[model samples]
Target: MTQKQRIDAFVSLGNFLRSDDQKLDILLDNASIKNPWYTKNNVRKQLATLSANLTPENLQNWLVGYPDVTVDQTVGIILAGNIPLVGFHDILCVLIAGFRAQIKTSSDDAGLTSFLMQELITIEPKFATYIDIVERLSGFDLIIATGSDNSSRYFEYYFGKKPHIIRKNRNSIALLTGNESAQQLHQLGFDIFDYFGLGCRSVSKILLPKGYDIAVFFEAIEEFRPISTHHKYTNNYDYNKSIYLINGDKHFDNGFLLVKEDERLASPLAVVFFEEYADLAAVTLNLENSASSIQCLVTEATIETSIPTFPLGGSQSPRLTDYADGVNVLAFLMDHATQN
Candidate 1:
């Protein structure tokens, strides 16, 4: 395939995933087996944005960056189920780069990914030879695995000899200047509540300016009351509320959610914690401790030269081509292909 043809194939892949508008609706509406972490609109939003990001022009530029990747190698992927269809990028990257993908789909979030993959193969039947969804993963040249901290340890031990990218549980955080507009802080709700805060990119903590009032934060989030209407989310909120209060754990009340002041990255859903900071430098040092478990940081204040910054809600809706490890995926995949 010509470089443009391969790039067009990727764009078509995204189009295929987005084309099943009705099926997408049905999956979003009823795909919840029992514990639902996503809704149709959430899935739709992700698909729409990711689709736009994989445009032919962008994919072509991506191909230019990698000048040494060989397309013949097959990559095995162990996907995470923390959020719905979270591992689509990995599949897309492998195919776009010209290698076949051996996928181990997560049982919890497999419905949509399989559907999308089926669509991709339909768009270009040749993709069938490149994509395999398997129950058990075996031999492959490279591996990309996402799992919990414990599972990541196992992945590293088992796939240690191969060229692999293994990801453990990571959380996102927000850096508050305490001067954010109500609109900006309200958008923070998307960071905290999207995908019911189950995605690795969901903001689980806020680094606050010293003596910041929790009242303002709660007021900003009040507009996002629609999120509470989801049954599973409400249950998590209420159940965790009782456990923490009964245990006398220190947490700030927000009427709809809870915030506790702490130095940790992972917090219960419908709850967020804060850590006061007098110096951004000091906060930067503290965050380094959790960097492995931290996915992205949302900030209103100027990030210190050392801290990474992404837009406030970019966590929940990452671009399709934004590969993990700060790598540009399409570039990585197409590095070895000679251009037409």
Candidate 2:
């Protein structure tokens, strides 16, 4: 297929996702029914984000740097099922770059992705040859796997010899200046609580200016208290709370969330770790030291750093150009295409 045809097909797929098809609703329903973590609303929200970005203009702009893939290599993608459709962007990249994708869907998210891919095939029959949903990935030329740090080692053991992009656990964080307005803090709530803090893009920690009243931050995030009602979230919250109380550890607890001092980047679900920083410079240094473990930053402050940073609420709303782990998948694919 020509490059224009492939791009046009994706644009059509985008438009199809935007439509109010009953089948789409049923897909979301099944997704939530099968996996408690994949709530119907969360699935819908992810689909909306994908549809919004998959436009003709966005597709053309994102692909302007690369030549058409004349080679017919297949990419084997091992998707992560932490949140709804987290692997869609990788699939989109593989498809738009004119490569076949042999996908091994995460068992947690298989049904939803299969349904979406079927819809894309309906939009463009040519894609049927390009997309292969497989239980065992056998005929792939390259690899792109996402999983925990431990699992990433397993991926490297199997796929390291091949051209691959193996991703590990990475958490997002927010920096607070003690000057954010109430609206901004409320917006940061999405970064912390969205998807019940399951996605790698979800903010699990916050860096605060020294002696800042943590209470203000908690008050602004009260709107997200509904997240506490979920049984999984409540179970995590209760377990963590009991542990902290039993050990007599110092912590701040709102009705639904847990906040405490933690130097680590990753936090447990329903818990937000924070560190009081002497200055932005120290925070920058610390972030630089831990850059590999961080995915993105959610903050209003424009501190000088190479790590990707998002606005208060933009953590989960990554644009089409915002690649995960700051690795441009398209660029990698284009470079691979030239070598072969």
Using TM-score, give the best candidate's number: 2
TM-score of 1: 0.90
Please report, in order, the local distance difference test score of every candidate based on alpha carbons.
0.76, 0.90
Query: Which segments of model 1 are wrong by more than 4 Å?
Result: 16-20, 33-35, 67-70, 305-307, 327-340
Q: Given candidate 1, what's the lDDT at residue 238? A: 94
Cα lDDT tens digits, model 1, 141-199, are 78888898899899999998987778877788898877899888888988988777888
lDDT of 2 by residue, 1-340 (tens): 8788888988988888899988888888888889999988788888888998989898898888688765589999999999999999999989888889999999899398898888889888988999999999997999999999999999999999999999999999999998899999999998988888999999999999989898898899989988887898899999999999999989899979999899888998889999998878888998988888899998899888888888899898888889999999988888898987
Query: What is the TM-score of each predicted model, taking all chains together?
Result: 0.90, 0.98
Worst 10 residues of 2 by lDDT: 62-71
Q: Which whole-number lDDT from 0 to 100 does residue 273 have in model 2?
A: 95
Q: What's model 2's overall lDDT?
A: 0.90
